[model samples]
Target: MTRRKLNMGKNNVYMKHWLSDKDRFADLINGSLYQGRQVFTAENMSVEDGEQGLVLRKTDGKEIAVQRYRDIMMKADDGTRIVVLACENQDEIHYAMPVREMLYDALSYVDQVNALRKNHRGKKDMKGWAEFLSGMKKMDLLSPVLNIVFYYGEDEWDGNLDLHGLLGLDRIDYRMLKKYVPNYRINLIDPKKLENLECFQTDLQIIFGMLKYRKNKEGMKNYVQNNRTFFAQVNQDTYNAVRAMLGSGQHLKTVNAKEGGTVNMCKALEDLYQDGVEEGIEKGLEKGIETGIIV
Candidate 1:
């Protein structure tokens, strides 16, 4: 696997802020995971505290904690069951993502079990020895958890996508072991690789579309110009995200956000394009003078 270290100066703050918005979060999940279906809505989903509290008790009474922090987490409860969705913003391709995600899901399940245990203890109900030790009733169920790694890096992901991908099963693993070994998969969302840009209903469409060419100044300028109707004005969050994703430039620094916290991406891109042209002309003259080619 090709692992590129994240730039020490770069961070995922902008991506976290962008994904924290419920509308954008739902759109991203639906578009990327659910075939563009409206599985989650801004109204139905409620943001939850993502601090991992699921812990294991020791014989000496000291709790062994598996603490983790998530960028954004949301929960939705229907009449039948509860569902949890967690987002982990990644600035680079995480080589051990499958195991990382597996732990998050496992901890969520353990938390659910703890909740069930507390409820049963409060009600003074325990049917058998199995329920008492397990911290859950026989019929008790756990909420399903889905963790997604939103990778917004400059390079393609070449790391393992699942637990099986990480294992060296080629030499010794037989079909018999497959039944005993449980495998886990990581849900990954790569905006640059998404083909269905229209699936997104928010500024995300513009964000994803622009991110695909973030490395190419010419392509980025063309993208903004082509989407001028929307790029002329974007909210502060989206603007900050675009600037962060594409990296800082002279023109980007010059464009002040509007009074109402909106930025003119169209104007910034145009100025940036103009800067490139002027630099090209100046550099050409410099080269010509150095070689005496223009004489």
Candidate 2:
């Protein structure tokens, strides 16, 4: 397992704040903009209510009470409702349930709400939702076409389990989030990210500002110049993109992310080279001493 060295720099500290605010960060990292209102509920409801009467069978006597429930709804800014259901802290029994069964549980919630609000409340048989539900039910069950997210902590999950691998939504799930919940649409928000002191320092605002500035062609060019160092650390493809932007020769107003400064990619590369050389020398000296038998 390759361990990542996390820098406790000002920017990383700020990342913690966004990480800590699970609801808030969930909106941001979800690749979905934070336009919808986030709603949490502990109350449960179903499509049909159960009666007080219970029936017993003669052959193999048994009694059961049937219940119904609906999925949680997140109302979006455009007045569209998203049906979201979360199943967490599931134990052995819940885990033993087939994926389809779990999905059915989520679907039942949507069904109950759809049936109850068909006319008097909300949009009656919202066309989009109806089609969406149908697709969920009729689609190939074994292929894993679900968007269930799982939230877990660091110690709880092994790195081998890729969250996107579990959900089969690689395009939707980003590289960072794949670290947790290796199969679900859910992201593991480190509680420590919330406690970071730098959150109050307006790191999110800075990131948001950069995102906003990168909207237009000229702005994007300037953003590349400002973030040359960061791009260099990423991949060659990313570096080439930045280089293209810089070479585009489009004049844009300088963003105040910091100030206009040379990235010195060669310097960063040199530092890495020097560190490797030092490590190699140290190892060689240790090995030589061990073999000399001068003790």
Candidate 3:
């Protein structure tokens, strides 16, 4: 593949490039959210705008507009149903991720409501006051928004995983409050915790597998050797993403180019440890720990 210098700033940008592929996007959603249930496929998915924005009227009649961008978003339609799928790439842990995701989901519903209302108003299809006031018919329902937080960090996650975890409502004193407040959970996909890497059909399988050993030089080398054929011929974006997330700069220098926009990952690994396995491993780990964004 065409070798390019790694952009150390915002590695998540590289992640978006490779995972943007329809097939790979579907594969990631299926494997991460559905546990390989095959609930989504590239054929039934269409890319959607990742921007979420809406205006809300407050009790004082003042309006506020807010906007947020998702790392990736798509529409999933399966004849009888449609759902919105969004992925948020994270290099470091956000302690308030649950609350952030909850806001994104709420705004998604608001966006849909605006669209549905616009269509109805254009067609002059309102039947009653309820439809007119709400901007949608009583029976109309919003598509469910499922957001997954894809954490590629190699370190153990010590952060809370749900809204309730952040709410501090689990104590006996707040039992009554906890019973009434529903919990919102994040669909977290951590490479270190992935046990069913085989569920992935694409290079995502091998990529995630190798990520689990990112800090372990010997272990990562072995994993690459084990999946040599596929990694040895990955697309430019794929190689860039993997190397970016894995902190390969401390060791890896050039990507050995091959035919058809592919690279030999085996040779890349060889150069990574050319100075000595332990030295390379130590440097990689030190750099990863320094950033608190290991993967």
Better of 1 and 3 by TM-score: 1
lDDT of model 2 at residue 126? 34
Candidate 2 lDDT tens digits, 1-295: 2222221132233333323333433343332222233332112211122111223455666665443321122222223333333222210122222343344444545444444444323433334565455533232122111223222122334332333444544655465555574242333322213332233222232333333333254464355457655533433322222222222132222222223333443333335445656889988888888999433
Model 1: per-residue Cα lDDT at residue 119? 93
The list of candidate 3 runs beyond 4 A from truth reads 1-9, 57-63, 248-251, 254-260, 277-295
lDDT (Cα) of model 2? 0.34
Model 1, C-alpha of 124: deviation from truth (Å): 1.7
| Worst ten in a row by lDDT for model 1 | 1-10
Each prediction's RMSD to truth: 3.7, 17.5, 7.2
Q: After best superposition, candidate 2 residue 37: deviation in angstroms?
A: 18
Q: List model 1 lDDT by residue over 25-77, tens digit each.
A: 99999989887788888888888888886568999999986698788899976
- lDDT winner between candidates 1 and 3: 3
Q: What tens digits encode model 3's per-residue C-alpha lDDT throughout 1-295?
A: 2233234344788788888899998998888767788888899999999988887799999999899998899999999899998999876778999999999999899899999999999999999898999999988999999888888754667789998889988888887898789999998888767889888888888888887777777887788888888877877788778876786423455464555678777887877766676777889999999999786
Q: Each model's TM-score?
A: 0.87, 0.25, 0.86
